[model samples]
Target: MNTKQSRIRRSRKTRAKIAAVKAIRLSINRTNSHIYAQIISADGGTVMTSVSSNDKEMRAQLPNGGNVGAATVVGKRLAEKAKGLGIEKVAFEAAREGGLVF
Candidate 1:
């Protein structure tokens, strides 16, 4: 499989495991030009909160929005938004399935 397909396969497996627990999920999608994150309900119909470099606030801080710094900034913003949405905890998915801890 190609790189993108392989990544999707990995992501599906991770999402399946997360779905098993049925907890609120904070999934991240990092693209070459931007980073996006969302807090999804356990059933996946609703998105409690979301943020990205494309957002107005983030757009100012991360004008380029395509670097590790931008990704980290998006992560922090999403977490803060989730907290405001009364989501104190979440299962974070890297979208890349990195070796880094959750």
Candidate 2:
């Protein structure tokens, strides 16, 4: 009905599909002030790893957390963490104005 509700509905559908396949997911959340990313377990019960522009290391290198540059850094960091954990594949889940994108 409302925008938020619609978004949630879409996300639920996407997540359901991902869960059905039992695939690890790389989820991303963006705010006006920061970008956050995480690797989630197949069951979606655990967060394997996470990275954000607000992290101490990122904050030190980036004067502003709300920008494409900061988002890139966060993405790179998340990728590194995933690789270190032996994660080679993931379903990408990112929020977009239209809906959640995979």
Top lDDT prediction, candidate number: 2
Q: Which stretches of candidate 2 lie over 4 Å from their true place?
A: 93-102
**Candidate 2 TM-score versus the reference:** 0.86
Which residue pairs of candidate 2 clash? none
- Write one digit per residue (lDDT tens) for candidate 2, span 1-102: 999999999999998899999999878889999998888999989999999998888999998898988887787777777778888778865542212124
User: Could you tell me how far off, in angstroms, the CA of residue 15 lies in candidate 1 after the best superposition?
Assistant: 1.1
lDDT (Cα atoms) of all candidates against the true structure: 0.77, 0.81
**Cα lDDT for residue 28, candidate 1:** 72
Check candidate 1 and list the clashing pairs: none
Q: Report the C-alpha displacement of residue 86, candidate 2, in angstroms.
A: 0.7
Give residue 96's lDDT in candidate 1 (0 to 100). 33
- In the range 9-50, model 1's lDDT, one tens digit per residue, is 998998899899998887777789998888789998898888
